[model samples]
Target: MGTSPDRSFFPGSHWLYFSVYLLAFLVGLPLNLLALVIFVGKLRRRPIAVDVLLLNLTVSDLLLLLFLPFRMVEAASGMRWPLPFILCPISGFLFFTTIYLTSLFLTTVSIERFLSVAYPLWYKTRPRLGQAGLVSVVCWLLASAHCSVVYVMEFSGNSSYSQRTIETCYQEFREDQLAVLLPVRLEMAVVLFVVPLLITSYCYSRLVWILGRGASHRHRKRVAGLVGATLLNFLVCFGPFHMSHVMGYILGESPVWRSLVLLLSTLNSCVDPLVYYFSSSGFQADFHELLRRLRGVTAPSQQEGSMELKVQKEGEGQGQDCTVQTV
Candidate 1:
């Protein structure tokens, strides 16, 4: 392995990660919270597999956003650990676990959607929601367990009081052995990337096939939109991040790549809300309705007030001097 001089791990785009975290904090939390409310609100009436997966996805996104504050602190302090050094590994573990869980559940959502649209009758008859919930819980639990390996390895922190008092977080190699990194890195690539990618591709392809073979036009169109949106998000939001990791794994990791990796990793939270918007028609309609209500509520009450004022003026102008008031 090759090594490079130690410098600011994230130099130019420190601002970018911080900004993305701010955005993730703003958009992701609220959207996922709303989704959770809506899904749980109607669970008694409609037990849907897709909704279950969506709930999982939303919760995962929420958890991922929860880590942003610590991230922002780290970035704002110029990549130094001002807090307890023990917290570093825990934070790192949570970060990777959340990422893995998100990918796993997104793939599950796509597969569930595919099955619901492509095999409606079978999907209805089968124990879909129950099965899906079990699977989702397993995925999250498994991801947590897998990522806990870092904690098990007991990685050392790079703390220094020189110049800037920097304390960098990194996994310590056992016995200075490359094999130690190999297993965890491979596990991450496989669980987080390979499996999810295969499932997504397969599900979307099957959806396309079903649509091509004369599925309902409305359903086909909706599914096509979903597939397009999901694929777009998978490519734009996640593809670069994982691809960069693959490159580093295959080529090599230098200090220069660290900034880029962090930048890509931080972006998934921002882009995922867009994916959620596009994938779920119910959510889109509800979100639009919410916007309309908000606009109506905040429209200065100007239109209604003006109408009331006009009516009152006209009433006063009458001979009886009657007044009409809005109740």
Candidate 2:
């Protein structure tokens, strides 16, 4: 096979690549880990249905963050993969896997929330935690299975030249490779992003209509921010990566553009914790306390006092206010 029109990712502005990935690691790691720890406590205290999905989202982001340093090194190495050949595809596989997992989990969260609010009567009648766990497990399994294609395709001589002496993780794809890759990715974008995006949009749109009417301005702002942030994440971060695949398939891969878009996608990991903090009690409590300690605030339980946080009662259907909109 001959080389495609695009030889490789155009190497320029290495500093920008290093900075974006570094920023993701610096902010995403501690916050996601803290969310996990706090959620563990919350799960033990009283498990909320959405907590399972949110926990999985945090885990997925954390997994993605783990790969950023290796990616940063590759960027610094003039966009050449300096790591082991095996590790390249593995990291790439994990990267794509976790991102789609985040999408599916977010979709599930929206659906669960819609059910809880739309039909609270039927929702409270059953055990929700078990159902949520089942959904979480299924999403992970499905996303992982779907993402196996990355490794399979890699081994197929599309991504790396395993047969040759050179072992690159992500190399320029030829025309034939792009022919196979583009359709697969377009399909994935539909399943992983497009469909789920529509589902989440419908769910959140309806929820906003229902929940926004009687809610306070503060509560409305939190819910609105959650919706806005999630949409912004998909559109700004993940959207271009997939769209680039479509455009690249049509116009040939611009490795530089794709690489830059991919970096932006990782920023979602850092942004998700902030979304979780404003939308969940456990995340808020942990983050608020961390900020207090950082600021040298000595008052105990001061977060609750200042925030005037409320909890969901046994019979309440609206959830826990802004924090109640955990989706």
Candidate 3:
């Protein structure tokens, strides 16, 4: 198959995109799948929200890896998209769905964290696992529906097939139809990028503020460092991609700029699990404890089974008071 015109549309991107896609998939898939099992199997004692979110994020990243293989193949083969035309739309839809869901879950985690620290009483009153499960289901449904807009618009069309004699699963935006394309692009930017970002930033900022006011220097430093890493990740990995898209919408989409945006966006997927580990105390503990056991640092923590973990600080040297307190 010849490289589609779109392949040549952004020359030199194939090499970079293929490299990034392969790296992300190879790294993210197993990491997330293992995280999924650990969160479900060992970390079950934590809050339902935490577990549910871990599951959701795992699925998101896993789905990205699943969809990426084809993309990697396409890029390696110079964007010829050797897969069947029918597979294109499905692939594109699934790709967008997974990424948006990842964003959604990340934002949700931030909100949950903010409440846990800043509004303890309110956070405690919120539903546990059952509620979190329902919310997670709702998130999946909502994300699926929202991202399916593209599928709905170009679900099946021989015009993209018969006329061009080229099959594409994803519909190209009509470059001339600025009115229609612009609004949809704007909405995608807002829902998938801006809104999630604002929510995450607000929650993390509030969490940092609350933690800063507390007395534990060790805890504060660790949490601060994690939060800083997380925030930096968002700014460095995701911020530029969305900002570039918005800039393109306002200014113009030069090929070089678009390729750069895509590159940054791809980098986000690869870096996200590290972000999760750093942003979350629970994750950091779990991951560190896992590595330590692997390296023979210490024995793994005894398996605490099937009860919620009531988060608390180090013991204050009181006998009966050593029981952990929930927020």
Top candidate, metric lDDT: 2
User: Which tens-of-lDDT digit does each residue in 1-327 have in candidate 3?
Assistant: 111336444457678778888888787777776577667654446555766775777777777788888888777776666777666667777877776676777777777777777777877777577867877887788778877766655544336565334443343444443334445655776887788888888887877788877638876776666566556546766676566557656753322344445555555566667656655567777877776666663322332321223222222334345454421
lDDT of each: 0.67, 0.76, 0.65
Report residue 275 deviation for candidate 2 (angstroms).
Answer: 2.2
The residue ranges of model 1 lying beyond 4 angstroms of the native Cα positions read 1-12, 153-166, 171-178, 215-218, 251-255, 293-327
By the TM-score metric, which is better: model 2 or model 3? 2
> Comparing candidate 1 with candidate 3, which one achieves the higher lDDT?
1
Q: On a 0 to 1 TM-score scale, where does candidate 1 land against the true structure?
A: 0.78
Candidate 3 ranges with C-alpha deviation above 4 Å = 1-11, 121-127, 156-171, 175-179, 251-256, 292-327
- Candidate 2 lDDT over 38-72, as tens digits, reads 77777888778888788889889989999878888
**TM-score per candidate:** 0.78, 0.81, 0.76
Best by TM-score: 2
**Poorly placed runs, candidate 2 (over 4 Å):** 1-11, 157-167, 252-256, 290-327
Clashing pairs in 1: none
Clashes counted in candidate 2 amount to 1
